[model samples]
Target: MGEHVRAGNLDIWTEQVGRGPEVLLVGGLGDTVESWQFQLDGLADRYRLIAFDNRGAGRTPMPDGPVSVEVMADDAAALLGVLGLAPVHVAGFSGGSIISQELALRHPGLVRSLVLQSTWPVMDPYLRSWARFVRRLVEFAPSERAFLEDFFLDIYTARAHNDGTVDQFIEEVLAFPHKQAPRDTQRFLDAFIDHDTTDRLPGITAPTLVLAGGLDPTARPELCRSVADRIPGARFEILEGEAHQPFQEIPETWNSRVDAFWRELAPVT
Candidate 1:
């Protein structure tokens, strides 16, 4: 269901599914097209969904020199242009949201609308400190499992933890091949930490929706709201009792909410 597509300078690994209006899903740091399995399955009936592995993640190879959000945004632009899927709806999660912001700014013609989930406009002191700790943990963790266990703490809600969802995630990740190397993970984190789009939000011409989890520790509702406030006519919504990854924990609800937003813009026939 996936193929290697020549986009930009890399042979980007991409997956496409379903039919109808095109929708592109962008994942966070260290994520791949597999990260949106739930969406690919749940939303495909109504959307022509596309997902891809970012540079240095999964099947995509890292290019020489450094990577930045702008570079990654350009990559997305190239992918869409190459596929002739321009003016498509774009949804970005966490670090992907940052890249999406840059994409909307740098290549506005490629984007029809934007959905930013678990997004932040700037890396504040709190997030900076947490990112620093994460870098240290990545550098020092004894094993991959150990690192993921600690990393999932900030990503999922208490309910997910209590209901064994986090465990399931760990099991799947451990079983999946093409694990992101530590160096690549650090490189992605470095790009995420250095990104800032505070003054540039107003430049994005795409209609935008910003969603945040009420219980998310990393991209808190308050911070996410600030992003919504900055963008003209962007809607902000909070999924109560959810954490950073509601799309995985509650795919049906997440998909329905997103579907409704898109429908409001262009009614489904």
Candidate 2:
């Protein structure tokens, strides 16, 4: 079950499961706790996982005025402090990864380790254009289903589309009760496009693992590599045959890889 917890100025909706080392799972733009469903189910047997809806997404209400990456990172930090879960393993995907980078830089003592998936250190022209296009779709797309159908093309591979995986995902999103408003979605995308942590990533002290998808168009391997290159001792790998969200597309493989990385840091006794 999920409940709203008082974190900072907002009541952040969070869900937790399992019992072991604590792990925080952060999702991408317009995502909620439900986004980490695969991880919650796959890794819960051996680890305690906490997943939350980012501000301006899901059941979480957006605060007044604009939201930035730093603000969102601070929200995560505050949540940890309130929950007494500091120094926990943190895993972030896509836009969530950008927020994770800021969190590590701002609250080094709160993060034990970081697993950044489909991340980038800076938004290049290609990425900026892509962000803008996504925002435009949010503003002008004919309908929610239409927007998702068009947007999934960049995130999923041809195999997923051909095999009806993307179709099922779209249906799930449609069925979900707490849908993100188009304006809020645009705001989240805007924040992502404005963020740049190129020089600051080196300041992160947490053990970090950066993973990219071989077939991802949004955050390509080169962009993801730049993030690892800047962070000292951070390992980078590409999940071959995967697209932007291998966690959803190939949950078994994704869960195993992330679990292995975490286990290496704090081996079972």
Candidate 3:
């Protein structure tokens, strides 16, 4: 079921499925709860999976002024607190992974375990350029089709693009009712660029899993490795041939890896 939780001034839209230990799923900058459709059922059977749209996306409208990764993390923590779901497992991707880092840092008691996928602890020249270029493209693109065409290349692998999966993705994106505004996207992109948790990884108490795609251009292998290296005992896994959207590209592998991590820590009693 889906409902709105008042996270301070924002009315964050949240969804829950199944019934067990809670697993919170945080998505990318402009992603909504639907972004985790592939993992919802797969993880829900074993964990009460909770997914929500961040502030300024989907049902949550952007508030005035600038926002930061810390704000977004606080929003997630607030939602969990309101729903009585502290110390839950958290899995986040791309921008969401950045927020997850902040969540683990600021609300350590609320996270039971962590999964950071296709994310970086610090934004460097390469990632900064990509974020800037994407913002410019979204602002000046003549049409949504042109934007999606350009975007599909960056997020999907060459094989997936050639195999028609990219086409389906474009269609799904076009079908969404609440498309992210270009300005809002730029704001979130800025948050992603400004976020740096490299110095704080050691403070995390949760068991951590960092998953990266060998072929991903966005969150490159070295970037993910650095994030994992900072967290004590954090395990890093590489999914060869997959790109930025590994969960979507290889659902079984993504879901199974996360499930195994969670199971080992707190098996069903």
Candidate 4:
């Protein structure tokens, strides 16, 4: 079962399962614990997996005013500390990847290893253009559902659309129990625009695995490679046919890749 815990000044909603080495899953913009549901059975068998809703997402109450990547990272660290699950293997997706980078840079001792998927370290022109387009969609869309439908088009691949996966995902979103406040959604969108951790990559000391989808349009594979190059000893790989959210599109491969990385770091018992 999931429960609310006091993390810093916010009541953060979190869920955990399985046992063994801890793995913390941080999700992207508007992603809740449900976003990581596909990994539960695969990863939970060998690790205690924890997933939480970031501030401005899902059940977590958003902080007032503007937010930053550092602020979100602090929230993740605070949540783990309060639950006595620090120094965990941190896996992040998209916006969560940005926060994960900040978490490692600011609280190195709290992160045992890092898995960054569909990530980029800098908000270059291509990304900034998308950010602006997202802002406009959020601001002008007639309704929440309308905004989501339009937004998903840019994130998923053509194959997902052809196979009805996009439709299924939209249904999932529409049926999700907790809805994020529009204002909170905007806060997260704005924070993503300002997030840039390129200069800070060298500070991370964790064993890092950077995964990118060859078909992912948002965080292109080459940009992800740039991130890998900046971090000392970090390895980068591209899932040829996968898109931005590979875990959802190709769970088996995503699970195996992530599990392999963690297993390598596990001590022989």
Candidate 5:
């Protein structure tokens, strides 16, 4: 069973999984906790997993206000307080990475090791273009599914390598809480588009693992490298032949890499 939380004035919804040290998994723009399907099972085997829907997404209950990634990070910290867990390992992807970076920088005691995949800590050309692309789709597209079908072709490497995955992704997208609410989707997108934490990266103290796809159109490897370079002693790696969704593109490799990072950080028995 799960419930809602009140972080000062902000509201949030969070779910906990497995048991050990807590591992918080944050989703990207308008994505639900279901997006972390790749990391859930494997990570659950080794540690507690706390996956939460960001404010204005899922069942978090946002009544419409300015939503900043830093404000969302505050929600994450509040969620952990409600859960009674501290200094947990945190993992985030894409839009989620923005929150993760803020969480570590602003609430250093609330984060242990970090896994940042297919993302950067700051805004870039990719984020700006996609914000317009999605807005245009909502405004002028003849068919929403057709719009996503084309959009995926450009962002996700899996579309070309495994067409079967797109069907599942579409289903997953539909299941998201804001899927049918354009205003809510736009708010989430706005928060993502405004995400720029370049000046804040030097404050991130958690040991970090930043992964990027060699061909990812959105969060390129160079951007990921910039994140790693900023974080003290953070490790950066690129998975060959993968794009925005490496965990989905090469599950075995992606899971293993994440598992290894968590294990390496865990205290010895």
Candidate 6:
């Protein structure tokens, strides 16, 4: 329910809750730690949960000018260090997944396990093109409606939209502290634009879980499955009737799967 220590040169605004094996959550750009709101409360009793705003986003102050994803990953590790917890379980969504990958790559000893959702090792050709297409909405269609429509069209399965809960979603997004900061937006997008870490997927040391929405054009199940195939002992789960934001789009299914993922690896201590 409060903030954690500053990591390196960054303040690293974060929310830490619960009291078991530490789990750190990272979110996409323009997404605050609060994006995890719906998932945290239920998991709090069993896990020591920490969610934070990445550098250049939300309350985490950017380092003057532009920053790279590598730096962002470092910030995440530093946050963990400050909490006196080493070897954490990590879960990242969208750009957050890239940050987790970078952390696992640079500091393999610090990660006990990994969960990647709605994200690929890097942007595939189609996703790269799609990102470029959506980037246009920043200017041409600045309104939330336009972006929401594009997001729904590009990411969600038809079944996800069947019940009509978008208004609730709109309010949640609006309530977040990260309401459309262009600098953070551009920096975040640029990091994924030409990056391709598929070659390095095999280097990850943690037991991995790759979660992808079946209908998400950006992080298709096939791409995430490919990521899982590369990592030793990694598992892939392709959820039907979901969107890019599956944790929020369908939390019960997400909560159940995530709870199981952790329980399966519950330490023998």
- Give lDDT per model, in order: 0.92, 0.93, 0.90, 0.89, 0.78, 0.80
RMSD (CA, Å), candidate 2 to true, equals 0.8
- Candidate with top lDDT is 2
- Which pairs of residues clash in candidate 1, taking residues 3 or more apart in a chain or in different chains? none
RMSD of each: 0.7, 0.8, 1.0, 1.2, 2.2, 2.0
- Estimate candidate 1's alpha-carbon lDDT, on a 0 to 1 scale: 0.92
Q: Name every residue pair that clashes in candidate 3.
A: 87-110
Q: Report clash pairs, candidate 4.
A: none
Return the lDDT, model 2, position 266. Answer: 97
Query: Tens digits of per-residue lDDT for model 5 on 184-260?
Result: 76777777786777777878888999998998877889989999998889999998788887776677788788878
- Model 5 scores a TM of 0.90
Residue 195 Cα positional deviation in candidate 4, in Å, after optimal superposition: 2.1
Which has the better lDDT: candidate 1, or candidate 6?
Answer: 1
Per residue, candidate 2 scores C-alpha lDDT tens digits across 65-170 of: 8789999999999989899997999999999999999999999999999999999998899989999999999988899999999999999999999999999989
RMSD score of candidate 1 (Å): 0.7
| lDDT of each residue in 155-266, candidate 3, tens digit only | 9899888999999988988988988888898899988886788899988889999999999998998999999999999999999999998999889999988888988998
Q: Write the per-residue lDDT of candidate 6 for residues 5-121, one digit (tens) a residue.
A: 678887888998888888999898677877898778878877889999887778777677657777788888898888888898999998889889889998898898999997676
Candidate 4 vs candidate 5: the TM-score winner is: 4
Question: What's the alpha carbon RMSD for model 4?
Answer: 1.2
Candidate 2 structure, TM-score to reference: 0.99
* Candidates 3 and 6, the one with greater TM-score: 3
Number of clashes in model 4? 0
Cα deviation of 53, candidate 2, in Å: 0.3
Model 1 over residues 220-257: C-alpha lDDT tens digits? Answer: 99889989999999999999999998999999999999
Best-first order by lDDT = 2, 1, 3, 4, 6, 5
- Minimum summed lDDT over a 10-residue window in model 5 is located at 174-183
Better of 4 and 6 by lDDT: 4
Q: Give per-residue CA lDDT, model 4, range 54-98, as digits (tens).
A: 987888888776598889999999988998977899999999999
For every model shown, what is its TM-score relative to the native structure?
0.99, 0.99, 0.98, 0.97, 0.90, 0.92
